[model samples]
Target: MGWFSKDIQTMDDLFVHQLQDIYYAEQQILKALPGMIDKATDPQLKQAFEDHRKQTETHITRLQAVFRMHGAAVKGQDCPAIDGIIEEAEEVAGEVEDKRVLDAALIAAAQAVEHYEMTRYGTLVAWARQLGRPDCAAELEKTLKEEQAADEKLTDIAVSAVNRKAA
Candidate 1:
């Protein structure tokens, strides 16, 4: 369903719909990470992608748990943000023939996704906690930490090699 569907009239309904949107985005990302891993030439970048691929799986699991806690059914609505990110990554990665350049672009794009996830989870956590759903907050916190760490790892890799190599 669309973001503004009549079914999601209340703030609570909107929040649940947003939750499903991110949940679906996480699942789409889980599918895309392997391609990023394969495209990356730097070992650090490769390993980071591999690690995040695993973490994204756990993130999906945690999101599902949060849904259950919220008493919302497990369902996913289309998320244009993630779709655009992935599409942009594919276009850039395809155009950059140089392996190093591809790796750099991949890292930048992946970090964009991490940043998006961090913001979403942070808001979700605050809302969950404010709504007196500590369980949901805790679950979101787990994914948020992982997202932050992933962003850090990407930064470290970019500074250490990916960015330098691309230049």
Candidate 2:
């Protein structure tokens, strides 16, 4: 179903729709990370993308488990938000001429994606609790923590080196 076309007659429906949305977003991130890893000039930044790619694999598994818990099929809807974020990242990365500047741009792009994920996972956790599925909430909480950590790590990398190098 299209974004607005989902029949969200109840909170449960909304919750499931959001779950699918994030699921799709994660898949897109998985596809994008390899390219980011390839484009990264700094060794640390490259490693971070690689590590997060692995973490994303675990996230997909967790999402699948959540689907099972919700009695929903393991699938995803189109997530244009993630697509646009990733596309912007690619475009900016291509435009950057200096390696250091490209690294900085990459960090910024990654943080944008992480911020989006943080919001989605945060909402999912709250909705799962409201839906009386503490189990699902607990699972989503794990992913939320990971996203927060990833964002913080990106910030640390940016402040410590990438941004200064770009300057």
Best TM-score among the predictions, by candidate number: 2
- Write the residue-wise lDDT of candidate 2 on 1-167 in tens digits: 45465587889888888999999999999999999999999888999999999999999999999999999988898998999999999999999999999999999999999999999999999999999999999999999999999999999999999999999
Best by lDDT: 2
Candidate 1: clashing pairs of residues: none
Off by over 4 Å in 1: 1-3
Give the local distance difference test score of model 1. Answer: 0.89
> In model 2, how many backbone clashes occur?
0
**lDDT per residue as tens, model 1, 1-167:** 55387987776776787799899999999999989988888999999999999999999988888899899999898999999999998999999999989998998899989988998899888878777888888889988998999999999999988898899
Measured against the true structure, the TM-scores of the candidates, in listed sequence, are 0.95, 0.97
Model 2: residue 31 alpha-carbon error in angstroms: 0.4
The CA lDDT of each predicted structure is 0.89, 0.95
- The TM-score measured for candidate 2 stands at 0.97
Weakest ten-residue segment in model 1 by summed lDDT: 1-10
Error of 2 at 127 (Å): 0.2
| Model 2: residues with Cα > 4 Å off, grouped in runs | 1-3
